[model samples]
Target: MIRSTRILGLAPRVAAARATALWPQLYHERVVDHYNNPRNVGSFDKNDPGVGTGLVGAPACGDVMKLQIKVDDQTGKIVDACFKTFGCGSAIASSSVATEWVKGKQMEEVLSIKNTEIAKHLSLPPVKLHCSMLAEDAIKAAVKDYEAKRAKLSPSKQRGSGGLINFIGDKAAIV
Candidate 1:
């Protein structure tokens, strides 16, 4: 027998197994998995051109999440994702799942992954719904940040026009 089993004996192990079986009633297995072993839980350099960052706070739940995504500028595919969350298990799991899902996906496609889907996968209760929403918001905010940064660096802004100009406006051309 293992040391734990030998010392504590089989009764506790059996009880733990039973509790594991019952724990899913309050938290889904997936949520438990993500919470116990959170994925991509960290920060990337916010100033990095390839990285996009999102910060969301839920005042009601007092949860704050910072999610970051790294994308291939040419391909628009997410190369990596990371998140840091200060909140409940559902919130942590939501962000963790978001990072896992967004990695390797196109930015546009990542936008389609919804809060409902995250909530469903985690079996979140109604009270915890906001947590999932925050995760979704994080993804959008990050993508928006990336797009805005890219726009600043775009070739259209570099055309020998002096300062920034409205590239799409015909009247403002070559000024």
Candidate 2:
């Protein structure tokens, strides 16, 4: 009976020590912060003309991310960004940082954001680099979606001669 009680007491201590030792190895401070209090942790209306949505996943890790952007048509700037990520702390942090980086930036500028920057910012480990890549890909995908939607609404035509023409008001150009 004494041996049993001693074993029970040591079990909790061993577990606590293991967890404390592994915690830092598992996630960085920024990753933990973002996972606990993620920014822009919601979705936008995908059907809204001014909004674009991108959903991407890492098949190896089963990490899924949905990112959205609302653009101002006149300036072609991202007025707002949001995201929903279902993955590890690194993935969540990567997406949260992505939304913050994109807001208030022009579409062209947002495209320049690189995964390496995000990974560096988060101090992500080599194994978790794919999380940052996922965020970068999500941003590009959302921008492409927005552009495609806008193109469908614009006055554009395809000529039988394999040429494309765009008509804006009274002006037309073929390329």
Candidate 3:
């Protein structure tokens, strides 16, 4: 009986070793780095006029990501960015990289960012591509929230009745 128990314990150890070996192969170096040391893992005040908050989720994976940006009121540039994600490593890494990319970028520039770019940067697999898409949706939602808040605060400044418009330059580019 003791001999049989020892063999069963060894079986578990062998399986664990195999899993450990496959772990590194499953995720790219950048994904692993971000997962281990995620950057901008926090939240900003959603009610702050200069802050925009975006909360998005993937129904397929039940992954939720909240990304926020603190924009410079004067320059219309994202002065800082942060996120809080409750999901897998890929989702966390996607949000972490999203925050990093948005910092110091103007609102329009930030909106132009694509999920494919994020996916490529993280080398996320096809199955994990939705994680990057979640990040992208979060960014767009946050920017939309920011614009909505601004519109509510300054209705007179807003051209037309409803709809988002770019307030950075002289041209009122409708979004």
Candidate 4:
């Protein structure tokens, strides 16, 4: 017959099993598996001539995101989009999904993507809204970069016309 101490010896194993069973229930939430194992989470050094880069952050949420887009200059169509994010799971998922959604999209069409769409795509919680905001800002920043560079090479600018001298700022372009 097992003594009380012997019975206590089995208590730990029983508790562990119970904890394991309850883990899924306790942690029930919608999370993006792919973002948890994010792919293409870095830079492309040798992109095409018409590619642009964007970096945006939210100090309040302590999240930073960088988005890069390769586009057909003449058609304003995005051939590729990629992202890097530093934050929680939701932030990473937001950036990841945003990149996928923006790729193969025309500039005008890409503009239609909103932060709410990214949040919905990731099924983010209300507390993680900053993640979607970062994605949205990054897209706008990338487009602005592409447009600025294109403007610099335009024929009108080649005539030494320096009217307002508008400029687009990317990560490095930031002062």
Q: Pick the candidate with the highest lDDT.
A: 3
User: Which runs of model 4 end up more than 4 angstroms from their true locations?
Assistant: 1-30, 46-49, 157-175
For candidate 2, lDDT tens digit of each residue in 1-175?
4346344456867867876678667888888778778999999999988998889999999999999999999999899999999998899999999999999999889999999999999899999999999999999999988877776676464342433466666787764
Off by over 4 Å in 3: 1-21, 159-175
* All candidates: CA RMSD (Å): 7.3, 4.8, 4.5, 8.7
Q: In candidate 2, residue 70 scores what lDDT?
A: 99
Q: Distance from true position, residue 7, model 3, in Å?
A: 12
Each candidate's number of clashing pairs is 0, 0, 0, 0
Q: What's the alpha carbon RMSD for model 3?
A: 4.5
For model 1, residues 68-117, the per-residue Cα lDDT tens digits are: 99999889899999999999889999999999999999987999999999
lDDT (CA) for every model shown? Answer: 0.88, 0.88, 0.90, 0.73
- lDDT accuracy of residue 88 in candidate 4: 73
Sorting all predicted structures by TM-score, with the top scorer first, yields 3, 2, 1, 4
TM-scores of the candidates are: 0.77, 0.81, 0.83, 0.70
- Model 1: pairs clashing at backbone N, Cα or C within 3 Å: none
RMSD of 4: 8.7
Cα deviation at 54, candidate 4, in Å, is 1.2
TM-score of 1: 0.77
Query: Which tens-of-lDDT digit does each residue in 1-175 have in candidate 3?
Result: 4346344457867867876677679999999889989999988888899899999999878999999999998899999999999999999999999999999999999999999999999999999999999999999999999987888887545746656665655667665
